[model samples]
Target chain A: MFRPFLLACAMLTVSNLTRPGLQPVSFAVEAGKALAIVGPSGAGKSLLLRAIADLDPNDGDVSIDGIERRSVPAPRWRQMAGLLPAETGWWADTVGAHFTSGKPDEASLGQLGLPGDALDWQVARLSTGERQRLGLLRMLMVQPSVLLLDEPTASLDEQSSAQVEQLLGDRLAAGNTIVFASHDERQVARLAYAVMSIRDGVAEPPEAVP
Target chain B: MSQYIALSYWDVVLAAVFLAINGGLSLWLDLRLEKQLLIASVRMVVQLLLIGIILKWVFAATSPTITAAMAAIMAVFAAREIWARQERRLTGVWGYGVGGGAMVFAGVLVTVLALTTQVQPDPWWSPRYALPLFGMILGNTMTGISLGLDTLNATVHRERVAIEAQLCLGATKWQSMAPFARRALRSGFMPIINAMAATGVVSLPGMMTGQILSGVDPEEAVKYQLLVMFLIGGATGLGVLLAVGGGVWRLSDERHRLRLDRLQQTR
Candidate 1:
């Protein structure tokens, strides 16, 4: 098993980011590990991810590496816990414009199978898979300790999906935590060390992968 | 010097004939706007006549309290107009307060500045000068503010996801919203910019035209019109800037979170 041993600690912790009358969701992801949240459509999977990112208003405590999310300023907290929505929004005219930290790393772009001139491409012309990959790359540039991704590879084909998985594997290998929601069985089997199933806001406590 | 032409009530009735022709055309085209035209004409007549009577009383009274009260009332109505103009308003008091407060603040501040510094009426609050100047500024500022608020809220709603994405990328609320604020300000300022550009060439400004019609010296009227235009421009710019800022403030929370839930669509 590939496990990063740099900093052994609970990198991402969620102590009930759920509403009343619903089962409270509580889980912890150790450094360099990935947790997959799987459930049917409209099962509040995205909502849970948003809650953990503190993107939405919700009850419960979310912390990173022993520091409560509220302790740090929101922008800093968001930087540490970067979120990639299923459909990322591109407001600027060019892809490079969306990247705030100048041009993104060319190596990361190449690893994602994006062309060398992809950053110069107009956002209106990018394919769905390209957008998703760019969104991931954009989030990665921030170098968040925890990556909150919603369907990170849903828009990609088998080859592109594998490339993304490989890139994410490298991130995990570097001791970054990942909490992602996926519907793909293969993705869950391949990436996650733990699996959490949520249905209609009720979440089962995470179980270890066999 | 040409004498100011005083039109009798019968002459005013003759002027209504032009509106009657407009109503006739609306009926012919099945525009279904004849009723609206009639009601609007009647309302305009009543409103203007009432204002005329009130102005006569106010000018005769020559009291600072009366002039200030009339200015306050005009400002309040302008605020109400701004509130009524938004399609999607900030959920509560913020909807009225943000734009309304901007206009009243800008309008009064600019008018007082002009009166005390430039226009310099005997008491500075003289109704003749203060009322007209304040009314013009309030009207222009109202348009600018309402347009700004509308553009800000609409763009924010349309680009909610994009803004959230920026926020997710660790952008502070102001940073995430800077572009939208710029767009809103442009929308707010465009009207005055166009008006200023086209004032003499494309259209005669109402105040200057009224002054000329009342037989004021052309050069003197031009100076007054110039002063009025400059004052309106300053007030509109300040009003729009403040309203847009307040709008951005209302739409977000202290944690730099974008709170789209703060908006309510009125349709």
Candidate 2:
């Protein structure tokens, strides 16, 4: 009972982090469940994701499992729950320079269609889609219990997108939680158990992903 | 000590002839800096002349209140100068408090500590010692803090997404901002460090030259210059830390979220 409750505590929950353009938005993603967020462009989808990641300033509560985000301290909470924004941040020039802790082997990189020596490649040289996949791989390296992904696979072609979807599916099979925003209806339908759409800043009630 | 030759006002005015030559060259070269040069020279003369009179009274009276009031005014002006130089300034009171407050606090503290401990003058409030030393420390501190504030603000702007992402990865605000803060502090300390390294090697320092002109023995002047340098170094370090620390505080909330909005200027 205690162990299951503890696992439940690892779920991703969002109350709000508001911008002037956004209304208070809230939702939860239970363990192993993927909540797909869909909206028209400028419906505060990215902003909502940022808020959940505690990147933006807004009034409301976000928690993991049963612990309030405020209680866990931001860094630990973020480590446990990760947010991969639509346009991922690349500060280091080399791919290998990005990850401080996670060192994935050559096979994993190959699986992601990256060369073994790709770690040494300059970030500026990487294509947009490649950067997108690498960003996702880096986040997974942190081994977050919950993932907040904003348009995680938007940049990838169909083949790369399929690989990313497979990787995400694997992550879910491990019983981790994910709240992802995507524009592609098919991706949402394939990945999400529940679908929530943003209309006028607030999330419409979630429905079964058809 | 050797008796140094004194210069009359006419002798000082004789030095102004070189400026006219420079101004003439600027005009002939079509650099168009004649007006600026003329205005700067005139302002310098007027300002120094006024300060000379004020210092005369301050030295004679030797009152703590007067000394404190003068130091306060200088700090306030230094704060304004620092605030004006920042590209990304904290809004409202914060702008003044972080940069200016750090400058004044570090400047006054180091000056007072150095004065009382190393260069103790009679009555302690001797404007002769406290005023000049405070000015030197404050000037160095002002530069360090201004550079620090600019670097910090620029870091927030440049690294907002990256920093925010770090925080999302479960970094404490300090952890998230550590690299940026280190960079800011390094840049802030660069000027003082360069000046120290170059002192007497690349160029003679102003205070050493001034003291030699005033007939102080070269060795004695060297000692005073060293003391002032040490004070300025310590004060600049403190000011830079305060600036970087204050910036870190202003740019983040307790929730470890990066407050990029705080970096916005009202202007």
Candidate 3:
């Protein structure tokens, strides 16, 4: 009976975000679906993702399920629609300190190809690929219903990228909606059910991934 | 008490001769600081002279309202000085209010507490006691608050990515900003801590030295200086806390978002 009415609604809906030299854009992501945003460099893919997360200021209406984003407290909204940026920032000395719930799930870390002892390691010692996977794991720990990822696998090798994609695929199977921006067409074809092309600040309507 | 030795105006003019050496050195070395040195010396003389005259009138009037007004004037100027010292300032009224307001709050609170509980002058708000105590507290509080606020905003600005990352994970604004706030407060407390440590050994504090010069017992002067030090330490800590708290508030919003746009580069 918890939000029984909103069960039928799209997981995420964004409408009319206006930017100079950028077309007004709007779209929706259905429950359990993945929408891949493919674009060239300087095409504002990250900007679109940030705007949707409400991390950056933009004129738009963004809603999770049937609830408007503004109606919920921002932190709660962010939890529901978590964003994973290209290069996630780490401030603490150890990786474990970054986790709010503390001591991130060991199974989840293994799924992302991280060792059990990774949490105790200093942040300065982490490789770029490790950081990317760990960042995704950190975001996943919050269990956002809708994941906004900006080049989630940009730094990973083929094996690591496969692991990440496999992890994301599991989340998808579990009914979480995903909106990801990537330069990798192969990743788009593998993961995204639908695709949107961003060109010169304009996002074309979503279409089936070829 | 020993007889106070009052200095004539000629004595001060003679002291001014000491500055000529610096001015001469600057010119000889081609450091090009001669003009600045001269200007600084003149400004200091003029400002101190003006304050001396104002203090004389203020003491003669001896009205609480006049005393409060004088304190207010000093606080306003201190606030402006705090505002101007920032590299990336909080925009709008906040740029002025956050640090300025903290300095005034801490300064007034500690000074009043000391006056009432310790000194207990006949009127409690006696101009002679109140004015100088407020001035010392305000000066130290201003430094702590300004340093704290500057550290806070600058660190937040530099660490926006890390802060935003925490926010995205559903952390409340306070949770995300706690580390930086702690760091800022530490920086703010450093100056006062060092000054206190060095008060007797490396340096004779200005207030104690002045008291000794004005025929006060050396022991009495030392006691007063200790009181001043403790007051300043408490005021600085409170001021730093308030300023950094205000800074964190200004940098974030109700939505738990880091609004770095609230800061602007000062010219």
Candidate 4:
């Protein structure tokens, strides 16, 4: 019985590695928890998340709750397992228009420490920090089951960064799986429940301490 | 009428001065080589002299077939220029497809629907009737196609992310590129809109001036100019709309994903 179980796990591992550009890099995250990825630039941290989100064309197997990510239609997968890159693009003229979900609630904006009237402002008028905050708000409005953030707070000041961390913590408590990439060790110490370092294209062992 | 005749010499001088100014500006801008300018000047003298001689024969013969042949030649020349101005080398298939499609569709629609149905000319394709009409339509179509292609290419380059993001968001290739399609079509038609606004009072259009110079009645010239304006406007609008709308769809794959690599390779 032990031998059969080991054989089944090996077969599953082999099958996962066969995906294009996707090697079997193993990491696990519990539902409603946050996993922080720390790596040097060009270490494939963003690529890993992109593969899981199926944004980068890749062959390896990735799943959300045992459902293969590729098996889902692209739009449906994006709706559920969204990746937010460092520089979020805004296509609409006004900040309020970016949200397909109704205008972002004042409470949510206030939690991010953004002005309540921010939704009415034109995207061109917003500062870089404001854009980042709005980008984060837009992603949360989607109500994604899995959130992949690539340097989400890289542009924010300490105060705004703390506000973002608090908001993310709230989301985690509410049961959303988060996989975030950051080069900042401080951010990892503050928000990461589990920290994994990526070097080259491979994932390193999770270090118990941030 | 006597006063107008007396001012004909001044008109000739004004036209010569305008041509000199255009030539000087072209030289200043380095848009013309000395050799090319020499060739162009020689060609202009030869071609216009030959046309002057031929016009006497055309007027004498009044042959509709000869007029039709001239119109066809003008369309072919305009099509060649349109094909050359596109930055990417379109497959011969697409060039011929867009060129022949615009010429035939616009040509037939304007000539039949607007011109013949409205004017009831003595011989529908008379040199006086067909040649100028064909020239105006073909010129506008060439301008429209050039603008459409340039605008489409620029939009693809500038808004690549928005396009890709839309595609990743579940938009089929065509749906993803809808913004570019709209921009290109709008750019292609903008000149037509501006020309329509500036017609008559702001500008004494070429055909109207030519008719007046050729001793036609002023009232008759105005009527023909009005008809030609509507015909060219309709032809250009249709040609641009069809060319841009059809051209954008071809830039994508069967999956509706834009084959950007293919476009970049050509560039």
TM-score of each: 0.94, 0.94, 0.90, 0.69
In order of listing, the candidates' clash counts read 0, 4, 0, 4
Q: Chain A vs. true chain A, TM-score per candidate?
A: 0.93, 0.91, 0.92, 0.86
TM-score of chain B only, all predictions? 0.96, 0.97, 0.96, 0.78
lDDT of 4 by residue, B119-226 (tens): 667766567656656677778777877788767866776676666555444456676677788888888888878887897869988878877887778899889887
**Regarding DockQ, does 2 or 4 come out ahead?**
2
Residue B174 alpha-carbon offset, candidate 2, angstroms? 1.6
Ranking by lDDT: 1, 3, 2, 4
Fnat per model, in the order shown: 0.64, 0.72, 0.64, 0.15
What DockQ results do all the predictions give, each relative to the true complex?
Answer: 0.71, 0.67, 0.66, 0.17
The list of candidate 4 runs beyond 4 A from truth reads A1-30, A33-77, A185-210, B1-40, B46-132, B161-183, B246-267
lDDT of 2 by residue, A104-148 (tens): 777777777878888898988999898888888787777787888
Q: Model 4: how far is B107 from its true place, Å? A: 5.3
Model 1, span A85-164: residue lDDT tens: 98798789999999884566567688988878899999999999999999998887776889999999999999999999
Best by DockQ: 1
Pairs in clash, predicted candidate 3? none
Docking class of 3: medium
What is the lDDT, from 0 to 100, of the residue A159 in candidate 2? 89
Which pairs clash in model 2? A9-A65, A18-A58, A75-B170, A75-B171
Query: Model 1 Cα displacement at B199 (Å)?
Result: 1.0
> Which stretches in model 1 have alpha-carbon errors above 4 Å?
A1-10, A18-24, B28-31
**Residue-wise lDDT of candidate 2 within B86-190, one digit each (tens)?**
888887789889998888888878988887888889977689999999999998999999998899888878988778766665668997788889889998999
